[model samples]
Target: MTHLTLALDAMGGDVGPCVTVPAALQALASNPGLHLLLVGDPAALHPLLAKVDSALLSRLEIVPAESVIASDARPSQAIRASRGTSMRIALELIKTGRAQACVSAGNTGALIGLAKLLLKPLEGIDRPALVTVLPHQQQGKTVVLDLGANVECDSAQLVQFAVMGSVMAEEVLSLRNPRVALLNIGEEETKGLAAIRDAAAQLKNTPSINYIGYLEGNELLTGKTDVMVCDGFVGNVTLKTMEGVVRMFLSLLKSSSTDVGRKAKQAWWLTLIGRFIQRRLAKRFGHLNPDQYNGACLLGLRGTVIKSHGAANQRAFAVAIEQAMQAVQRQLPDRIAARLKTVLPKSD
Candidate 1:
């Protein structure tokens, strides 16, 4: 029998338990063996549970506590001081083996800090990077690592991220021998920073992984690379920039108003134009569901810690729950540890 439990932060995001609860209910309907330990004020979540049917409600276990950690609180202090905070409690469940993984769309900084403290990285992992799947044109999904967790990283760290990400794509997405690429300014041999150049050399020499050389930002959506790697600062900036651009284009598309003159038969044409634009925008940027990405998986940690966007919606929360379930099913952490054990350590 599959025995997996997830600890969810019911009071983490902007929507709080409202979104989190519904997502939990959604996940439970499909996964019977999956148990949920919702951490928040019992009273608050109980009302949400009232809306769920008895069958789904029985699968959930509400672990109520008093404190709530605001996004403004210092992450380190917040995790250290707030013992009863929902995020900390969820982490505790994973640490204590009560839950297989933890998912929270809470304060990302605090989530990262708390997770690092609670679940130490694999024996030699210098950093625990966040990995998110970016939508691709033909290949379905692509894995990008170090998405804002470690701002400063060495060449060795980048290489490690590539190895871990390769394993993830193969395991989770079932991509056989996923091709790896280092994110660089250009595809040329000597076009990146010192770190990229060094990582490129390291990757060339690295065995077991299908390293496909360097890739620029434009290559990400083309499905040319299955696993893209970079330092946290660069990856984070790129992710945000792409998201911003999508939003900007979507806004422009929405604002393109057709002139329906009072003395002309352009009203029908205007309506047609409006419908076409709406469909195109929805088809293009509609996939920008943060909920679909849900929470990012904190790779390199001993256990899984999923970080959700601060302003995540119900869709995002639901997606996060599914991601958490997939992580447990794939045995990602153990696979990563085993693979890393064979890789050479970075020289000081």
Candidate 2:
């Protein structure tokens, strides 16, 4: 197989080169058929590149960029002033077909704006939705969409998100005839806002999707549906809340184990039991770790663009790169366009 080429915005995210450089090296080491274009200042990236193995250097190239977009910069400011920044340059590579995908941990707003501007949206897609896979109870994963890309969506936009998200689930998760649902306060047809109700009605009539009716927010991770669709505001809040709950539960588990060890220092049997329990809990909750699922894809774009969490560490950023590679290999944009052609109205 030919090597997949991906562009990395090396100066993106909180730790920038410190995290991205190592992540890039790690991704190269794991995937032999992967080529990476690291876009950032040569001066800043050279020292980090020195630490990489000589063999991997052949597959990695540094494309120097002078500027870096600030993590807090507004989307409008980034769009105007970030012309030569690493984030923008990496996206340009995708637009020009020099790279199959682009991954960045820059400001979410800025990344979304830049990607939409550079790559444009797919046909019949008025706006792109931010999508990510969340671990489900059935040992599979659920695809969630509009995770902070557009806070408000009309009925038609919600239907569009469902179509795009369903394609993502089928392509990335390999689900056949994936069940799609609209996120609502209740499962009843009468529940939720007018837009959601209207979207639900449209989805029920649409032949392309396996429309599964309304799903309450509580069913998000229960594996009740393969795809969960919502406006950005609701999706973002739900995602963050779940992340926080996972972190809190894990923290408490660790604290409890520490307390048990201290209290049972003289009792070897008790310590052993506590250690065993802690290990089991850790192993089970490992799937819920947000770091391993760091990438949020900007779906419906003509080209692939993955947004890594701004605060992502090396491991998390590596996961983001993997997400981008999956989307590229799956030809996500083309798949979405094909689905839309059959489902969307001729006027779109």
Candidate 3:
């Protein structure tokens, strides 16, 4: 896309500048048209960039901040004490039109609270949802929403999530008329909670959504549908569980290959076969790595904000930055607003 600037809360994550600064440098190197405003204490940020190449430095600037939001702080507390904080500064930059979006690995509650207060939700959206992209059974992608944004949601909010997720899938993944589904206990119409069943009825009546009934936990990666909508409590637990399982499986594949290789060293035939199987397994499931999909966007707001994993390493943080760039390039907020205008429920 064209030249775009993004504000990054450099002091928000676990290691703060240690992770974000290098990630910023790496992102600048990869995307020549991108500029970054690193918001944090200069004392903490300058040293990290001191040895960097001057060309990269030209496109990056450091915006000074006096404080940072504690990772474990309550949302209300963080917001009340947010003045001069790195996260607040980064967000303010967006509100003032100096940046297209903000990316932070900061306190989740604080980020959501500040973003909603500053950027404001889209006119028809009751609340913004945290939506993420995941790889499907095939080469396609599936999008899930409310990944820890709102722990509890009403029927109206659930239907709103479906709309937000559908718009995001189209805008970010380039999908056409994407199939949407509710993450539920079972596929049967009468299976889930009252809110879920009510949302199901609402989705069924909305012709624009292309609602496709329910998706069980096991069916998430099956590519059965393009969008999975759920309240935050279930979605967050489900996402963490999926990540842990995928990691365990990938670890087992590697360990199996090593064990087989050691035991088969005396037999050339066995060694050759073991190597082939290892390569096949790795090729088949390598893309399932969770780090590659670490960034989750808070959708349905007036401006874009990408939430990177607080413990994300350099490569993962760069991926978050790239996601923000894509959202900005595609005008994500505007697209969702336009979609909501047409489909927002008349009441509720």
Question: Can you give the TM-score per candidate against the true fold?
Answer: 0.90, 0.98, 0.95
lDDT of 3 by residue, 88-170 (tens): 99999999999999999999989999999999988888788898999988888999989998999999999999998998889
Candidate numbers sorted by TM-score from highest down: 2, 3, 1
Q: Model 2 over residues 232-323: C-alpha lDDT tens digits?
A: 99999999999999999999998898678669655878878888889998999999999979999999889999999999999999999999
Considering summed lDDT, which 10 consecutive residues are worst modelled in model 1?
255-264
Clashing pairs in 1: 291-316
Q: On a 0 to 100 scale, what is the lDDT of residue 77 in model 1?
A: 78
In model 3, the worst 10-residue window by lDDT is 257-266
lDDT of 1 by residue, 30-94 (tens): 78888899999998988887767888787789987787788778877787786888998999999
Q: What is the clash count for each candidate, in the order shown?
A: 1, 0, 0
Candidate 3 global CA lDDT score: 0.93
Model 2 local distance difference test score:
0.93
lDDT of each: 0.84, 0.93, 0.93
